[model samples]
Target: MRFILVNGMALRPRILCMLCCEPIGAHYLKEFSTGLSFCGHDCYALYCGRWISRAEQVKCPAVAETSC
Candidate 1:
């Protein structure tokens, strides 16, 4: 199992995919942790609301802004 160091603390190894729940590939952000495992780089960007050069469907929508 792979481990990630966050603020000097070791985070438990966990799968990044939303289906099988296994860490199959590299993570986008080192500190941010999520259970959603993307199938590919395209899927990763789509999952994170990143715009690609080509036309592709956006999976996860951006969060709504809120005033605190």
Candidate 2:
């Protein structure tokens, strides 16, 4: 949750991208699992890829070895 400012005054509420922190307007992408919104598909894909990498890193060594 964020806000738009005008002349140093808060004017309206806004939704910012979870990854880039850019304000999103009427149209945006949302990740249901995390309730995170993205400015565009590119940002969304980047976030998803980031999560995938994190998941990979947290795998147990024995489980990872067995999966291969």
Q: For candidate 1, lDDT tens digit of each residue in 8-50?
A: 3333464364433445444432313444444344445444443
Clashes of each: 6, 0
Query: Which consecutive 10 residues in model 1 have the weakest lDDT in total?
Result: 59-68
| TM-score of structure candidate 1 | 0.27
For each candidate, give its TM-score against the true structure: 0.27, 0.63
Q: Per-model C-alpha lDDT, please?
A: 0.37, 0.61
The alpha-carbon lDDT assigned to residue 45 of candidate 1 equals: 47
Error of 2 at 29 (Å): 0.7
Instruction: Put down candidate 2 lDDT per residue, 1-68, tens digits, no spaces.
Output: 12222232321477788889988766676665566667767787777677656667887565344220
Output the number of the TM-score-best candidate. Answer: 2
Candidate No. with top lDDT: 2
